[model samples]
Target chain A: MYPRAFDYLVPRTREEALEVLAERGSEVKVLAGGQSLIPMMKLRFASPTTLVDINRLPGLDAIDAVNGHVRIQALVRHNDIIRSDVVRAENHLMTSTAPWVADPLVRNRGTVCGSVAHHDPEGDWASVMLALGAEVVAESRDGGTRVIPIEDFLVDMFTTALEPTELLTEIRVPRYERGGGNYQKLERKVGDYATVGVATHLELDEAGVITKAGIALTSVYVRNLKVTEAEALLVGRAPSAELFGEAAAIAAAACDPTSDIRGSAEYKRNIVRVFTERSLAESASIAQGS
Target chain B: MEINVTVNGTPHTADVEPRMLLVDFIRSTIGLTGTHIGCDTTSCGVCTVLVDGTPMKTCTMFAVQADGRSLTTVEGLKRNGELHPIQAAFKEAHGLQCGFCTPAMMLVGSALIEENPDPSEEEVRWAISGNLCRCTGYMNIVKAIQLAAQNSTTGGTAE
Candidate 1:
């Protein structure tokens, strides 16, 4: 189905796109790769008066290493991030999660920032970004750019801390000291959304005791669920299969899995418990190897 | 808007609506019926085409956005009335039945072989998973990709 008639603006610069966004505010929608927005528009869920095409916007599709951490532009495509040498080397979790996003064709059009801004609870990037302690950079018409931690950025399901007049500029991931991470998602088919997804990061010391851990679960609630209790359980403890199982149980208990045709709430919870344990154990092994 | 793009090696300029999709522009404006539009959403890769070198879903892209870019549709695969290796392989392998999804399947398969000449059966399946064929001839399609990869001699011998 064709989307409703709208004025299209192909802005060559971020300044131009922001200017249009500032003036039009909620009446205007930013088009990154049109992966999410177009589908929504066609379905009449979103009927904007103007479309600000920012594909040509400068400095929005780059990946760089700065401040000892990897920085990615919000407009970077999924395939681009997956293929970036610096991102793959420095952030293996993000690298691993990128390929599982959708099929290759979807990755060619989906943008990292767009996904974050769209803020779908079932989206793979949100939980992975949350697990990595990623930060978001947003610019408003008031000439101020704010940095928001991923924790605070995701306010709830389908919502963010971003103002209507603000446009996301980039996402900043902090430099981790010594951590190996893994992302595992359970899907029914090739392009279907996750039924239960887990992203885990484990940092161990020479003694193989967990120094730090981050666990984020998605597609189980209104937003990406952070298993804080699970992280606390593993901290300062030896990364063991039994410990991982206990933490996974805690996380599974924390999730409020919704019922869908993909699976029942009970089934989703079961997978969450099992995958969480497996992912944590796998991440621990990789951490030890590293 | 008047947009300029090179389709199948020929540069053409057309006056069209800003909202016109790339697939519509190619089929309606350029009169190339080789590419089919099965699903407008990016889900079905029936409208797949090479933007620069990577395969993209034409239904999700606007004609205006493709201005000044090099586009290679399925129509460009043939030379001097000779079928591309991928098309020939599909014919030999009986990869297509209904033919609704053939153009897109061929485009994605050809592009996959070009990138990875010796793609495994799993890799080939993953590569064309975006393109759906209701006929359920996926096994033969996979075999056709294997044949094309072997013929390319770029190190892809389907396992």
Candidate 2:
């Protein structure tokens, strides 16, 4: 099926794109990569009157690392993020999770920001970003900018708290203090959406005891959720398989999974438990190696 | 709007509607039927093509977006009246049957080999995961890519 007819605007700059979005308001959808938006449009799920194409906008395609933080542009495709040297060094979780997104062809066109904006509950990046304490930089046409924490960015299933006139411009992630992060996802097939996924970021003190633990679970809730209880259980404890299992149990109990084509709600909940354990264990290895 | 693009090494400029998809432009306007459209949904890689050395789903792109870019389709892979190594390997290995998916398979396969000279069986399988084969000739298709990677003339083996 074809999408409804709509006016297409290819803006050359971020300012021009914002102006178009502000002028069109809810009637316009910003097209970046089009891996997510176009498919939804073709399926008649999204019928915006205008599409503001931002692929040509200058300076929105960079991966910069400075001040122990990595700033990624909204237009950075998944493949480019995986190939980025800065992401490999500063945020290895992004590098590890990006390759498992769909496949090479989809990754070549899907952007990290686009996936976040699309707000698919099953998307891998959302949970990873949340666990890493990433900040989303959004700009509106009124020259106002707001930094939305990943925890508050997502409102519900396939919904974000972004305004119609707002454009997602950048994603900022701070470097971990001591340990590293890891993402674990379970998919039914090679390129299908995840049934359940977990992202864990752990930092240990010099004494080899866990100082900070951040955990986020996805595909098992309305949106990516931060499991504070699971994280609290990890603080001040040594990394152990049994401790990770307890934390994973807390994470699984914290989620409210829904039944879909992927699996039953109970099945997804079980997978979330397994993935959380795996992610924590993997993060611990990176922690100990450092 | 005036849209100009180099398709299969030949440049063409046409006045296309602002909403014209690149795949439609190549297939309908340019008459290069070698590029097939499987699912308009962009989920299938049947509309795959190379845009300035990078593989992209043509159906997901606008003809205007490709105005200044170079596009390589299945029709462009032949050189000096000889089939490209991917095409040669496919022919020798019988990598196709009904042939509807041949163009897209070759386009994605060739692009994968171009980016990764030597690809493992799993890597090659994952590279074309976006393309679905109803005839299920995947075994021979994998063999074709392996043979192509082995030939030093095709491109130096990657890994």
- The candidate scoring highest on DockQ is 1
TM-score of each: 0.95, 0.95
Error of 1 at A31 (Å): 1.1
**Which pairs in model 1 have colliding backbones?**
B117-B156, B118-B156
lDDT (10s digit) by residue, model 2, range A207-239:
889988889987888778889898999999999
Question: What are the runs in model 1 whose C-alpha is more than 4 Å off?
Answer: B154-159
Each model's DockQ? 0.64, 0.62
Per-residue C-alpha lDDT of model 1 across residues B1-159, encoded as one tens digit per residue:
888999999999999787788889999999999889986867778888889978888888878889889998888998788788888888888889999899888889888988898999999998998888989889999999889888778543232
**DockQ value for model 2:** 0.62
Please name the candidate that would achieve the greatest lDDT relative to the true structure: 1
Please give the TM-score of chain B in predicted model 2.
0.93
lDDT of 1 by residue, A120-178 (tens): 88898889888788899999767689999998999998799988778888898876666
Q: What is the C-alpha lDDT of each candidate?
A: 0.86, 0.85
